[model samples]
Target: MFAEIITIGDEILIGQIIDTNSAFIAQELNKIGVSVYQISSVQDDRAHILKALREAESRSDIVIVTGGLGPTKDDITKHTLCEYFGDTLVENHEVLLHVEEIFKKYISSPISELNRQQAWVLSRAEVLHNEYGTAPGMWIQRNGKVVVSLPGVPFEMKHLITTKVVPRIIEGFKRPFIVHKTMITYGMGESAIAEILEPVEVRLPSEVKLAYLPSLGSVRLRLTGKGPDKDQLNALVQSEANKIKALLGNLIYGEDGGEPIEELVANLLIQKNMTLGTAESFTGGRIAQKITSIPGASAYFKGSVVSYATQTKIEVLKVPQALIEQYSVVSAQVAEAMASNLRALLKTDFAIATTGNAGPTKGDADVEVGTVYIAIASPKRVIVEKYLMGSQRDRVVQKSVNKAFELLQKEILKL
Candidate 1:
């Protein structure tokens, strides 16, 4: 089955509030084997809402509407739904009780007539109780079609839909089994990854769909399977995913929505009973921040020193002053020195250090912009890698940080 989600809000259209409702609804619908065909956003106007509702009903088996069901005046979804379903406003004692109870929990005042009227929506819809807020969710079934209207507040909508609406839809509809798998990849651009997997993409069955979702430093490769039998569908997708994995190999870091690179590195270190420290210059303390964002990182993460200046690199990380003078701060020699010095200073099992000119302007006139050096200090040796990234300061910094973590991840794997 298919559904269309219509979010009615001027805030969404004007970009004041993000339309997170659509993504939540789509994922829920997909989980129950229902596909979301289209999503639309309209302002709080009766004519526009009615038009969108009509179009949605014609195209989809179900139309899920949210927003504009507030007690306040710009909320017109309830009234429009009433007109569409050929019903007049009627006072619901149960909904009024819910609304009044919600108010009493917050304030010590009695409910007003306006609050009572807010609970009284068209009786045609199956009044779905809103446990989180004053507004009630509505469900209407007519002419072999279903339309569900929910409150715009995310928590309230979540409670009503998960507890009531989704169960009803699952019972009412018969849908094919759907299976999906995702592969996460890094160190390759989207176009390059796509080109590498083009042959695999072309040979997939008609029931299978492949989607590429590219992000800041990685691409999520999603493979969706739709068939009558759930097991058969899953097996088919898994087989194809294995083929993609074989082609991509270790370049495919983790799979199916893995943790961020920093978290992955931290977990690996913890698993191996290793401790890590960092000495960062161009990246500031961003490397440490990313690593510490994961819980339980304190156990494996020794510490980090933001040696942004040459003096700090020498004094804090204890990078040799002679190395800095000879090769400059943005050189591989300084990066290796920083890693080795921090490794000894912090007394950690492993250390990662970054030294680079992350810049719109060059750190040294002759060094050029975006010249990055990453060093991973292992027990045996310190491995250093050089990169000349783009000219943009932020992009250069981000890519350099990601690459440094990736290199550290490789070093951990070796141990």
Candidate 2:
């Protein structure tokens, strides 16, 4: 079955409010084997709403609409929907009571005519009750097509769609079976990963589709399959994923769209009952911030010191001034000193340190722009990595943090 989503609001068109409802609806519909053909954003006008509704209904088996249902005079979705369906708006006593009860529980005020008008429903539409808000959802049908109108508020719309709308649509449509698996890869750029897996990509089954979604530091390879049964599709996707993993190996960090790299590292550390700390230079305190975002991080995360200045690296982190003078601040020797210094200072099981020129300009005569050196100091070993990142300062900082986490993970694996 095919579906179309219409998000009705001038706010969306003007970029005042993001239309997250369509994305939610699309995901839900996709899981249920219903294809979302198109998504539209229309202004809060009666004529435009009607035109969009007609166009969506003509092309889709299911039409989902959001917004324009409010207590104010500008809200005209219910009236326009009534006109389109050749019906009239009539007061729904149950919806009015719900509105009054909500108001009494919260505002403790008398009911107004505008609120009553807002509760009014189209005569031919099925009322989808809203538990979280005042506006009741409407399900209207015309010319063998389904049109579901939901509240624009994200929470209220989500509840109605999940509890009420999705169930009804599932009952009416013969949905096919669909499954999706996502692989989260790191330590490789999108182009590099693609180039490495070019042969596998070329031989992919027609039923399975692959999409690369790249973010700041990693790429998520999502494989989606649609078929008539569950077991076959699952086997097909699992086989494809195994092939991709064998080709990519350690470059594929976590699978099935797992949490951020920090979470991945935290899980590994927690599993090993290991403690960790950091000494930072160019990335400030971002690495520590990412580590602490994981719950129960204190179980393994020891501490971090932002030694951006050479003086801080020497004084606070106890990096030898001779080392900085001999090898410069953004050098492997300084990075190793910072790591070993923090490991001893915090008395943790492990420590990670970064010293880098994350900049749009040169930091040292020998070290060009975006020169980064990351060091991991464990009880048994000390490993350092060198990378000449791109010219973008923020990208250099972010990629440095990710690489530091990757190094931490690698050291943990060695242990």
Candidate 3:
């Protein structure tokens, strides 16, 4: 089925509030096999909303309206919807009681007439109760088309869509099953991976499709298959995934919504009972931040030292001043020293260190922009590699962190 989303608010156009409701609604609709035909935002004006509603009703099986369902005079969605459907507003006793309870339990103010106005819903529409807020959602239908009205507040809209809207849609319509499997591969660009998987792509069945989603230094291969039979569709996708994995091998790290590199590294560290630390320079402790985001990281993570300045590296990480003098601070020698010292200082089995010059202009280091040296100190030895990431400062920092994890993962496997 096809659906259209209309987000009503002048605040969206003025950039006062972001229209996050459409994205979330579209995602939920897609999960139920409803394709979003278009998404639009309109001002609080009545004429504009009526025009949008007319256009959507002509082309879409379902129309979802969010926003402007408040007690203030500017809120016009409920009234405009009543006009479109040729209905009138009436007081719903159930909704009136709900509003009164909300004000009594949480809101200290008494129920004024304006607050009581929230209980007035469309006379002909099915009221979707709002357990979390005063604005109750509405579901109206005419000529076999559905129009669902939801509150613009993100949490309230989400609650209605998940609890009230999704169940009704599922029971009311038959939707095809959609299954997606994603493979995350590091150290490879999108074109390279696509070229390697060309044969697999060429042979994919009509119901199955492949997509390449790339970011910075990695590519994600997503395989989506759609059909009526859920089990048959899943089996077909898994068979194709097996074939792709056979070709990609270790280049394909994780699958079926591929886990992040940090989570993968965390699992390996915990399984092997190894501890880790980091000494970050220009990379800005992002590596440590990513590692610690995983749950149970404290079991294997010791600590980190964000040694950004030359003085901090020399005094805190205890890198020798003569070493920074001999080679610029952004050297492999200094990176190695930082890693080895952090491993010893934190008493961890493994340590990662990074020093780089990522800039719009040359910073303290004499090296060119995007010149990065990354070192991983394992129990066996310290290994360091140098690379020239892109010139953009943020891109260089992100790429450095990714490459650091890749190197550490490889060394951890060796141990």
List residue ranges in candidate 1 displaced over 4 A: 363-369, 391-393
Each prediction's TM-score against the native?
Answer: 0.94, 0.93, 0.93
Residue 181's lDDT in candidate 1: 91
Question: Model 2, 1-415: lDDT tens per residue?
Answer: 7899999989999999888999999998897889999999999999999999889888999999999899897888888898888899888889988998888899867778887776789988899999999999998876678999999999999999899998988887788778899998878889998998898899999989888998767888998888888899999999999999999888888876567778888988899988999999899999999988877999999899998888999899988888888889989999999999899999988999998887766654257888999999998988888898888999999988888888888888888
Q: How far is candidate 1 from the true structure (C-alpha RMSD, Å)?
A: 2.0
| Global CA lDDT computed for model 3 | 0.92
TM-score quality measure for candidate 3: 0.93
Considering every candidate listed, which one attains the maximal lDDT? 3
Clashes of 3: 0
Candidate 2: C-alpha RMSD to true structure equals 2.2
In model 3, the runs with Cα more than 4 Å from the true position are 256-258
How much does candidate 1 score in TM-score? 0.94
Would you list the C-alpha lDDT of every candidate in the order shown? 0.87, 0.89, 0.92
Distance (Å) between predicted and true CA of 317, model 1? Answer: 2.1
lDDT per residue, candidate 3, 23-116, as tens digits? 9999898888787899999999999999999999999988999999999999999999989889999998999999999989999877899889
Model 2 stretches astray by more than 4 angstroms: 257-259, 360-369, 391-393
